[model samples]
Every structure is written in structure tokens, then in C-alpha cells.
Target: MNNILRAKNLGKVYRVGKIDIHAVRGVNLDVEKGEFVSIVGPSGCGKSTLLHLMGGMAKPTTGKVFIEGTDLSMISDGERAKIRRDKIGFVFQRFNLFSALNSQQNLEIAMQICHNGNIDHQRIKEIMKLVGLENKLQHKPLELSMGEQQRVAIARALVNNPLLILADEPTGNLDSANSYKVLYLLKDLNRNLGQTIVLITHNQEASKIADRKIEMKDGMIISLS
Candidate 1:
């Protein structure tokens, strides 16, 4: 299908005892295959909440999330988990790598969980090469720079060759130079490999790397360009 993801009137509401806090409201979105789209917004504007809903990490309180034409709200939690593992690759702001595991091992765990089958060593190597971390495969998180660690995280995400990648501020911990490099790497993956990506960021300059930019505020999308 041309659209890898679709959200229909999606909403998420948190019950804080006496009050209901609406995080996402009436969001309708379509993400085409191989498109690099970024969701940009200020803190507390519901960008992360929206991403969580899209990734199937959190179920929406209202409406539905359709991934590869499958309705998330209609499926069981286990089914949704399977879809998250097999179809969506998530890159978070924190590297989230195991402290003791080397870059290669970190990726191996992800592959093991998602593939639920034989590990593909060649695929792992290719993804490491793609992220320019072939040499650092044996190094643990402490041995690598923040940018390299993030690169390892990215490589881990790509190892599965998923239908879509959801990166949530993957460069948030880096310096300007590292952020620039990471952003371009994502851009290159999208351009050369036709990797579909949806990134969430509050940095306006960083959001420019995306093919499409979506702005959100007050629990809703304000603009998409």
C-alpha cells in the first residue's frame, strides 16, 4: 500500500482523577511509504503523545490508528505488539542501549525480539555500514561518543528493515554537529533506501531535514507543510 500509516480522528485522554486531560484530539493523518515526515511542536503540545499513538505503544482513547491498512483499535494488544515489532522501528531520544552490551549485541537483541526467527548476520552488518558504524560494532555504549551511540541506536532500528521508522528526537542529546550528522543520516536513509520515517522534534531547524513538516499545538496539528 502507498500509505504505510493512517490515523483517523485519533485522540488520547489521560484521566487525572477529577479532570480529563486531552493529549491528542481529532488527528487524521496519512503517511505514504518511503516518505520522511517530521512532527514539530513545542514541549507539552502532544507531539510525543501523538507519536505514541501512531507507533501502537499507547492506544488512543478515541478513534483508530491504521497501520499498513490494519486497524489498531480493532486488534488485540498482542496483535498490536506484533505489529510494533515487525513493522515499526522506534528510535528514541535516549539511546536506551544496554550499558554492558556492545553495539552489535544491542542490535542482536532487537533482531531477536522482532524477527522471532533466525538472526541475519549479514543484515546487521549492512545496517551498521549504513550508519557508518561498522568499526564500532564491538564497542559498548560507554566507549562510543553520544553521536555514535545514537548511530548504533539507528542501526538497531534499521536492522529489521521495517516498513516504517518512528524516531522521537533522536538527536536530542547531541551537540550541534552531531545533531546535524544524525539528521542527515536519517535523510540519507530516506532518500537512498526509501526508508519511511516519522520523526518528532521541537527544533525547527532540525525539522527541516524532513520531506514534510507537521506542526502541532494545543493537542492538535496546527499546520502541515
Candidate 2:
């Protein structure tokens, strides 16, 4: 198994006025290819901060984040952005879809913005099919249910064929039924597509869906199972 991501003694600090607030304190993590790992924590537990650091959205105040052997802190912002664009896919709690564009078009826009290049029709089709949204490709966001919209979001994350997926509270906006559906979809994606996923959630049941779950508290990891 290839170690796709490694965070060494990860730490982050935000300076406000004269105080230094530590958000993540010596939090280390490693994620291998084709693995589904969930980080579970309460709000303000620093899980989201860790996700941003891991995905290269923010630089850490201490330690280092390594993605596919590239040290996130040592690289230039443009280089990190390229690594993020080429290797990491992100899914947020809100289904960040374009309301005006249909599902396929939404995916097309993501591919275009990431590389400013042509779309891969076959890959798009395969991703849509994998997320079970093949029939909904022509439908706008408003036309689909919350669950379907989330499915589209997942497809959009996979459109680039990224090496890793970083999903933050992906089912936060869904009802229990929809949440279950979304979790099931994620499990299926991990198992069938062989996609590596690192899901961050406050929901315990949601975290259990992953192959391993790490619990965080007060800017540090407390348990892993």
C-alpha cells in the first residue's frame, strides 16, 4: 500500500492580538492509498483545521504535511495549489453545485477550472455512473433531491481522478435517510472505485462507516480504532 499522505507532528497556531491560539497540537496522521479513514470530533476540536492543512488549503504554523512525497510547507503556494488541483478532491458539507448548470455541466466546469483544458468525456461518464447519477446528468441542482445533489458533489470530487478525497461533514445537511444514503455511497466508492478517502465528521455513526476512525479533542487526537 502506498502512503499517499503523511502529516508529521502537525500543529497550527493562530495569533490574535498578543495571544497564540493553538488549533492543532502535534497531530500526526498517515493515509495510505485506497483507504477510507474518518476523523471524528466535536466542533472546534481542530479536525477541520487539520483537514485544511492536510489538503494544502492552509499552511501549518509548525511541523509539515506531505502529500505524495511533496512537502506542503516547503513548496511555493502555486506548487501547492497545483498539487491540490491535481491530487486532492474536496467535498464540503454543502453541496457546492452551480444551481444554473446541470449535473454534467457542473462537472465540466470543475474540470475546466482545475486545468483550463478540455474535458474527459469518458472519465466524466464513468464518475457520474459510479455515483449513481447517470440519469440525473441533465438535471439542475434544484431538480434533484438533497441526496442526489450530494451524489453529484461526490461525482464532481471524483471527476479529476484525484489520488485522495477530503470530505468534510459531507452529510451534515442531509436527513437521516439521506445521510445513510450518502455514507453508503461513500463506502461503495471506497470499495468499488478503490478511491482513498479521509472523511471528517462530528457524527459518530458516520465515522463508523470508514475503515478506521480517529477521535480528536482539544486540538489533539485521543483515540484511533
The C-alpha local distance difference test score for the whole of candidate 2 amounts to 0.92
RMSD of each: 0.9, 1.4
Off by over 4 Å in 1: none
lDDT of each: 0.93, 0.92
lDDT tens digits, residues 1-225, model 2?
399999999999999999988999999899999999999999999999999999999999999999988899999999998888799988989999999999999999879868687888788888898888888889999999999999999999899989999999999999999999899998998998899999999999899999999999989999988
Clashes of 2: 0
Q: Candidate 2's error at 163, in angstroms?
A: 0.5
The top-ranked prediction according to TM-score is 1
Scored against the true structure, residue 30 in model 2 reaches a CA lDDT of 91
Candidate 1 residue lDDT tens string, 23-122: 9999989999999999999998999999999999999999999999999999999999899889988998998899899998999998999878568888
